[model samples]
Structures are given as C-alpha cells and as structure tokens.
Target: MATYQIKLARSDTDAARHFTLELDSRMTVLDALFIIQREHDPSLSFRCSCRVGMCGTCAMRINWMPRLACQTRVETLNADAITIEPLAQLPVAKDLIVDLGPFFEKWKRVRPALHPKDKDSKQLAIVPPDSEFGRQAQVKRDCITCGACYSVCGITGSNSEYLGPAAINRAMLRLLDPRDGNVDDRLAVLNDETGVWRCHTQFNCVAACPKGINLTDSIMKMKRSLLFPKKFHDKQAAT
Candidate 1:
C-alpha cells in the first residue's frame, strides 16, 4: 500500500479540500474519489460512467492536464500529491463536475448526424476502406466527445461562439462522407467566424484527447478546403 494526498478543488470553498489515503499502486483517480466520498466525505461529488474510459463522463483536470479519471492511475502519475478539479472553460456544477452544456451545444451546431444524399435508393452507399476519404476518416473518427479537448482549448476559454475541437472534428467527418447531402449547410456552419477559422492551431486539443485524435488536422483540412474549394472538389471527385 502507498500513502498519497488527494486535493479536491471545491467550487464552494476558497481553499481546496485535502484528504489522505492508503491505496494500492494500481488504483485509479476514480477509485480514490470513490473512497473519499464513501468513507471521508459523502458530500463530495463528481461524474463517471463506464469506468474503463469509454463513456467519457469521468473526464476532469488531473494534475493540471485534462484526462479521464478512470484511465489515470495514481502510480503512473508518479506524484505523491494528486490535484483533481472540474474541467476548465465550463461552468462548475459541483466538485469535479462541470456543466457539459457548452460542449454539446456546439456539437449540435455541426450537423453531426449523417444525411444521405440518396435516401430513397435501394442500394446502400458503400465506402471502401481503402478509399481516400475512408482512409483519412478512419484515423480521425474515434472521438468519444469527452469534452477534454473543449476544456483544454484556449479559444473556447475565451470565445463561447467558437465551435471548439470536437464539433469541428465531427463536421469534418460528416463533410468527408461521400453520401451525406447536407454539404452546403454544414460547410456554411464550418466557414462561419466561430468555426474552423477561429482555431489557433495550438494543438492543445490534440494533446488532451484521450482517444489520441488529431483535432488540429481536422480543423486545418476544413480551413484548406474553404480556401480552395476547387482543389477539394477535385480530390473528392478522384476518390
């Protein structure tokens, strides 16, 4: 067993609350929070689901880096003291729980769902895995919408209108689809002042994404496509 200090950033208090715990090295930050809430302070609050890191509800700022609490092992951090706080650039609903409203609001703006161009066609639109758009989409499509990228983005911290990383990534996914008919509308949204052009290309979202998605790449592609619509159309036509 190892002894460690857990610091909780409380929204209601000026000083962070501290707790000491004796835990196994393999235990995760989520485990420590469970212990603190169950044994130490029942009032302590946070959000988590699918403890294996899939659901993305466990995302928080751990040791000043945005990450999934369930995926962050105490031993791996190599710090005797662990600082846990709610995600940045969002309203704190409670201890370690931030309102994800802003993240989803932008997500909805990108027209995330697929809109088929040939809805009544009997044949299904097949996307070959080896195709150009398919190859590019495969590498960038694993985002779980954890909001870690949104929280870490500097633009989002300053401008609420900016669509943020996840939304732009989703827009890229939809835009790349060969069958999606909502191109004009989606592109208009992406070209807006608060869209891909707003990204500073800091790569902060890339580093913070637990899924390892290249969010900056998606934003840059959209920017390039906007600047050269003919080139973008030619590439898509060749595929």
Candidate 2:
C-alpha cells in the first residue's frame, strides 16, 4: 500500500481539490478516481467506460501529460503526488471530462468512412500486407479516436480549425486505400491551410498517443502526397 495525494483541477470553479488515497501500487488512476468519488466527494465528476483502456473514454491530463487513466498504473508514476486535469485545447465539461465535440468535429471533417469505388460489387479490394502503403499505414490504423493526440497537439492549441493528427491520420488511411473513391475530397481538406500545413512537426501528438501511433509520419506522408499526388495515386493504384 502507498499513500497518494491526488490533486484534481476543477473546471466549475477553476480550482483544485486535493484528496488522500491509500491505494495498491498496482492500482490505476481510474481506480483511484472511483475511490475518491465513492469515499471522498460524490460531486467530483469524470467520465469513463470500458475500464480496460479499449474505449478511450478515460483520457485526461495525468501529471501534465495526456494519457488514458485506466492504463496509467499508480506505481509507474513514481511520485507520491499526482496532478489530474481535463485535456487541454478543449472545453471542460466538468472536473476531468473535456467536451470531445471539437475532436469529433475534425474527425467528421476528414470523412472517415470508406467510400469504395465499387460499392455495388461483391468483390473486395484487398491490398496485401506486404504493400508499401499497407505496411506504412498498418501501425497508424490503431487510433481509437481518444483525442490524446488532439490534446497534446501544439497546432490545435493555437489553430482550432486545423484538422488534428487523428483526423489527418484517418484521411491518410483512406488516401492509401485504392478502393476509396473520395480521395479528392479528403485531399482537399488536408491540402487546405488549416490542414496538414498547420502541423509544426513538434511531435507532441506522437509522444502522447497511448497506442504508440506515429501520427507525425502520417501528416508528413499527406504533405508529400499533396506535393506529388500522381506518385501516391499510382502507388495506390498499383497495390
């Protein structure tokens, strides 16, 4: 057992609340939050679901870094005190829940759904795993839309109109897919001033992603695609 001092930044009053918890070293921040709410303050509001980290609903600023509360082990912090706050660059809905509306809004702008060329055909367009775009985009496809990338992004902090890393990565996935017919629409968004051009390559999103996705790479690829669209289109078509 260890004693942890949890400092929660409250949005309602723009204040901080301190709580003392005696928790197992293996316990997660989400577990501590639940204990705090149950035993300490019922009004301490936060959002969570699928405590195993699959839902990505428990993302928040833990120790000044965006992370999944459920996956952050108390022992791993190596500190007696922990600072918790809502994700930056977003409106705080309550204590730790930031409105993900802005994040999803950019996600929608990328048109994430697959618009296949032959939607009426029964055949599937399958690119082999050994293909260039397939291998490059495979690891990046695990984004759970947690907004961690958005929270840690430097561009999103200053430029709200910028399509964020997750959204851009979604666009990259579609762009690499030969079957997707809406490439022009996605490219138009990414080629805009507020699109991939806004990213400063600060790589804050890369460091903050719990899924270990290389979001910056996707942004760079899109930038290259914009410069040489025919090459990317030929590669996609060849695959």
Candidate 3:
C-alpha cells in the first residue's frame, strides 16, 4: 500500500481540496473516493452508480481526462497524485458532479427515440451482420449516455446551443436505422449550424468516450448526408 494525494475541485464553493489516502495499487479511483468519504470527510460529494463502467454517473475529469472513476485504476495513472474535477462544459452542481440538464436537453432535441415506419410488421426483422446498416447500428448502439463525449467537446463548450457529440451520435444511430420513420426530421435538425456543422472534427469526443464509440466518424457521416441530400434521399427511397 502507498499513500497518494488527490485534489478534488469543489464547484459548490468554487474551491478545491486535497485529500490523502493509503491504498493498494489495485484499488480504483472510485475506491479511493469511497475511502475519503467514509474515513476522511463524509461531506465530500460525488456521483456514482453500478460501481462499474456501465453506469456513467461516476464519470469525471481525472488527470485532465474524462473517465469513469470505477474503471480507472490508480496504478495505471502512473502518478503519485491525481486531480478530480466535474465534467467540463456543464454547470457544476457540486463536487465532481455536473448538471446533466443541458446534455439531455440536446439529446431530446435530436429525437433519440425510435420512430418505426412500419409498426404494423409483427415479425422481427433479422439484420444481416455483414450489411452496412447492421454494422453501423451495432457500433453506434454501444453508447451508454456517459456524457464523456459532451464533456470533452470543444464546440459544446463554446456554443451553448450546439448539440454535442452524444446527441449527434444518437441521431446517427436512428438515421442509419431503416425502420425509423423520422429520418427527414432528424436530418433537418442536424443540418443546422448548432448541429453537425458546428463540430470542428477535433476528435476529442472520440478520445473521451469510455464506450469507444467513434463519434467524429459518425458526425462526418451526418455531414455527408447533408452535403449530398439527393443521394441520401434516393438511397432512402430505394430501401
């Protein structure tokens, strides 16, 4: 076991505090936080659920990178100390917790819910694994709505109205789905400046996503649809 220093940025009071912990090398960042809350300061605040990567609630800025606390092992950080801060580009509700309202508002604006064109089809359609749509859907569906992509997005930081990577990624999933009926509406939403056009293609979102979703590529796909509307529309018609 070794003692390490942890600096936590507390937004509630607009200050940061340092805490020291003696932990095994195998212990995770979340484990250290738990120890701090229990032994050092019960008043310390953070959010987490599932204690696993699946629940994105534990996401924060660790060592200047967005990551799930539960998934980040202290040993892998290769440092004697670490810094913890709330997710970027969002209002910090408290220590290590940012308001998710704006993130979800943009998510809702993209219309993430599936609107099936053929609701009458009772039989389940089997999408071939080798098909283009099938492959794209599989890749895009892995997003757990962790907000890491949004946290690291530069466009979202500068443009408050800009729909971040997560929203765009969600839109891409539905856009690629053949059964979705609202493709035209989604396309219109994405065509706006605050939508796909705002992305600088910096690829920060790609790097930040813990689920490994290729967000930049997905955004580019949406941009291509806008650039060549007729081709995309015709393809949709052909399907």
Candidate 4:
C-alpha cells in the first residue's frame, strides 16, 4: 500500500481540492475516487457506473488524458500524484462530469437509427458474418457512447457545430448497413464543412476510445464514401 496525492479540478465556482489516500497498487483510479468519497469527503463529485468499464459513465480526464476511470490502474499511470478533471470540449455540470447533451445531440443529427428498406417486415434480414455489411456492422457497433473520443477531438474543440468522431462513426455504421434506406439523406448531411470535412485526422479519438473502435478509420471511410460516390455506388451495385 502507498499514499498518493490526487488533485481534483473543481468547478469554476469552487476552488480545487486535494486529497491524499493510501491504497493498494492494484487499485484503479475509480477505486481511489471511491475511497475518497467514502472515507474522506462525501461531498466530492464524480460520475461512475458499471465500474467494470462497460457502461463508460466513469470517463474523465485523468492526468490530462481522456480515459475511463474504471479501467485506469493507478500504478500504470507511473505518477506519484494524479490529476482528475471533467471531460473537455463540453459544458461541465460539476466536478468530473460534463454535459453529454451536445455530444448526443450531434449523434441524433446524424440519424443513427437504421432506416430499413422494409420496416413492415416481421423478420429481419440476416447478414452473413463474412459479408461486407456484417463485417462493417461488427466493427462499428462496439461504441458505448463514452464521449471520451469527443473529449479529445480537435475538430470538436475548434468548431462547436462540427459532428464529432462518435456521430460520424455512427453515420458510417448506417452507411454500411444494407437495410438502411436513408443513405442519400445521411450522406447529404455528412457532406458539409461541419461533417466529414471537418475532421483533421488527429487520431486522438482513436486513442481515447475505450472500446478500441478505430474512429479515425471510420471517419475516413465516411470521407471516402462522400468524396468518391461512384466507388461506393459500384460496390453497392456489385453487392
């Protein structure tokens, strides 16, 4: 067991607070926060759910990096002191909790749901695992809406209206889905300055994604689809 210092970035209205806790080497950053809340300061604020890293609610800026608190082991940080802050590029509701409304609202603007060609059908079409649609669906469906990608997105930081990586990633998923009939509408939305054009390919979103989704690759795929419509059209016709 070792004692480590934690510096929490409080809200603008409040001064930052520091806490010291002695914890085992194997304890995660979330575990340390829990100890702080349970033992030292019940008033300390943070967000966490499904401490196993599946829910993605525990995401925060740890030591200036956007990451899931539940998955970040303290010892792996290799720092004597740790700093925790709210996710950047969004409104901070409180300590370590940013308003996800903007992030999700962008998602909605991209029309994430599958607009099936035959919605009235009682049985869904089965896509083979080896098929193009199936492979793309498998890769893109892993997003847990963590917003870690949004936090570190360069385009998002510069342009408030830009559809961040997550939204664009969702757009790519719908584009790859054979059942979705709104391809034209979705592509029209993405073919704009705030759409696929805004992405700088910084790769920060890929690094921040906890699920290991290749967000930049997805964004690039969307870019290619928009840039060379004939290629995608030829492939679609072939399929």
Q: Please state the error at residue 149 of candidate 4 in Å.
A: 0.8
lDDT of each: 0.89, 0.89, 0.87, 0.86
The best-first sequence of candidates by TM-score reads: 2, 3, 1, 4
User: In model 2, which regions exceed 4 Å deviation?
Assistant: 14-16, 232-239
Which lDDT tens digits does candidate 1 get at residues 25-93? Answer: 999999999999999888888999999988999999999999999999999999999999899999999
lDDT of 2 at 49: 89
Residue 96 alpha-carbon offset, candidate 2, angstroms: 0.4
Model 2 whole-model lDDT (C-alpha atoms): 0.89
Better of 2 and 3 by TM-score: 2
Highest TM-score, which number? 2
On lDDT, who's better, 2 or 3? Answer: 2
Listed per candidate, the RMSD to the true structure in angstroms reads: 2.1, 1.7, 1.7, 2.0
Candidate 3, residue 196: the lDDT equals 95
Clash counts per candidate, in order, are: 0, 0, 0, 0
lDDT (10s digit) by residue, model 2, range 41-100: 888999998998788899999999999999999999999999999999999888899999
Q: Pull out the clashing pairs in model 4.
A: none
What lDDT score goes with residue 74 in model 3?
96
What is the per-residue lDDT of model 4 for residues 1-239, given as tens digits with 9 covering 90 to 100?
88899999888555547988887989999999998888877777889888998898989999999999999999999997999998999899988889999999999998999887677877766788988678877887889898999989988998999999999989887777766767777787789778988988999999899999999998888887776766445545643
